[model samples]
Target: MAQVLGGITTSHIPAIGMAMDRHEEDTPYWKPFFDGYPPVRAWLEAQQPDIAVVFYNDHGLEFFLDKKPTFAIGTAPQYHNADEGWGIKPIPPVTGETELSWHLVNQLIDDEFDMTVCQELRVDHGLTVPLSLMWPGNRYQHIKVIPVCINCERHPMPSPKRCYKLGQSIGRGIRSFAGDQKVVVFGTGGLSHQLDGERAGFINKAFDQYCMDTLVGHPEELTRLTNDDLVEKAGAQGVELNMWLAMRGVLSEHVTELHRHYHIPVSNTAAGVLVLENED
Candidate 1:
């Protein structure tokens, strides 16, 4: 049967991708942020999971104000990166496992989580940036991906509890699949920073550290936090941390923290990355 080997959580700040694309990694402004991911890339090279279930939010690239689903799953045979009005990243397209995706869709529906299934979906930096950080040098082409999108841009987004429960359901679904594939789940976006408003340029290192520490064993306590509380404390965009909660819910109760990196001011955001493996 297919097995979920582990999960990764990281910030998906577009500026990080821009730094990489522009070859500015060594520059003083971006070097620290770039330095944080080499260990992640190394860890991924070792684990080499066949598939990645990517959890991220769209930033008006594919879905706009016209129509947006609170939860969406990509079932395409391949997922291409989007322009996002700044041109596409020069990376190979990510392959998809349609059969497994269909199975997950069915299971999620059965579990009472209504998800919009996308036969065609365009991925933006939110999804691809993390892949680049985790699997640099076009290594992303080697593995299949299932894009699980959460609606963090819009209001009335799924609560922390709901995202966590959905992840639990996803874990159950992956275990039920008959294929012998090794999978990794990813929760992308946030470690606290506000991008707009008078309170823009906010960064909450304390809150971000609290989440990184607590999520390992006390995720239930995080579920008690409301989106408003997250926005107030972590920053507006920090609400995206709910995506991390979902990723956490997919792992075994006891996971070993294999790697972690955190940095400040990655373009109005506090960037963070974590790799956790199931305790065998």
Candidate 2:
């Protein structure tokens, strides 16, 4: 049977993608941020999972105010990157595992999670940036992907509890697939930093650290926080952390955090990264 090897969580700040695209890693402004990923790259090289189920939000690139699905799954054979109004990030297209994606879709619906199925989708920096950070130098070409897009851009988004439960459903779906594929799930976004309004540039390092520490063992405690609370404390965009809960739910109840990297003010965001493995 297919096995979920583990899950990874990280911030998907667009500026990080730009820094990489422009070859600015050594610059003083970006060096600290860039320094956090070598270990992640090394870890991924060793794990070498065959598939990555990416959970990220769209920032008006594919879905706009006209229509937005709270939960969408990409079933396409391949997904291309979007411009996001600033031109597309130069990266190889993401190949998809269509059969597994369809199976997951059916399983999720059977589990009472309504998801928007997309046969064609364009990924934005929120998805591509993390992929780049994890599998740099086009190593992403070696593995297939299943894009799981969650709606965190608008109000009435999925609640923290709902997101966690959705992740549980995804974990069940992956484990039930009849194959020997090695899979890794990703929850991309957050670590508390706001972008916009008078409170813009707001960040709560304490709350971010608490989340990183607690999510490995007691994700249930995080569900107690409301969206308002996340926005107020972590910043507006920080609410995207809800996506990480889904990634966490896909793992074994007990997980060993193999790697963690956190850095401040990565383009007005508290960038965080973690690699977790299901305890054998």
Candidate 3:
């Protein structure tokens, strides 16, 4: 059976990707944010996980408003990164863990969760930025990827509890897989920041801190918030915290927070990164 090493969460702002493309990590504006990843990268180097299950929301790259599934999983053998108008260069193709992905699809469906299974999918910054942040350059090619996308753009989005349950289902599936690969789950996007509307550039540091602290030991508390409550407090786009909840769901009931980084006003977003290890 596969071993779930742990999970990671990072903000997936396209501007972060653009900064890396422009080699601005050390610049005054970007240095503090970029400085947060070295310890995480070192940890990855020490524990080279064989597979990564990424939880990210689509930003009109692969799915659009016209046809967006609440939950989607990639079962393709390889996922390609394309130009998504973020002006950032697309990274190399990511190999997929097909067999395990199929296993997860079966498990999720069997667990009474409706899922959209994609045999071919094109990824955007939502998926790629975190990879580049963690692995740097082409080093991410070392592990196979499995993408789990949640719909953050449309109404009727999955509730935080629902997404967390999805992660639980995925965790069960990974443990039951007939292989011994080490897996790392990624929940991308959000601390808090509204992209548009009357309260554009809105951010709630208090809520963001509450979430980060609560997520370490009491994730269920976050699930208690309705989508409206989340939007009202976290800002519209800040609701992407669903992805973080999903990542936490995949871990053991007990976990240790290995590292965390939080910085505000990164492209008008409250960027965050967390490293959690499953406690036996």
Question: Which candidate gets the maximum TM-score versus the true structure?
Answer: 3
Residue pairs with backbone atoms closer than 3 Å in model 2 (clashes): none
Q: Which candidate's lDDT is highest?
A: 3
* Alpha-carbon lDDT of model 1: 0.88
Where does candidate 2 have its weakest 10-residue lDDT segment?
A: 82-91
User: lDDT score, residue 83, model 1?
Assistant: 68
Task: Give the C-alpha miss distance for residue 124 in model 1, angstroms.
Answer: 0.9
Q: What lDDT score belongs to each candidate, Candidate 1 first?
A: 0.88, 0.88, 0.91
Between prediction 2 and prediction 3, the one with superior lDDT is: 3
Clash count (model 3, backbone only): 0
lDDT of 1 by residue, 1-280 (tens): 8899888888887787877778898999988888877777777778878999999999988999888999999999998886677664645688888988999999999999999999999888889988887766656777899999999997989999999998988998898999988999999999898988999999999999999998988888999999999999999999999999999988888898988888998888998888888763
TM-score for each candidate, following the candidate numbering? 0.97, 0.97, 0.98
Clashing pairs in 1: none
TM-score of 3: 0.98
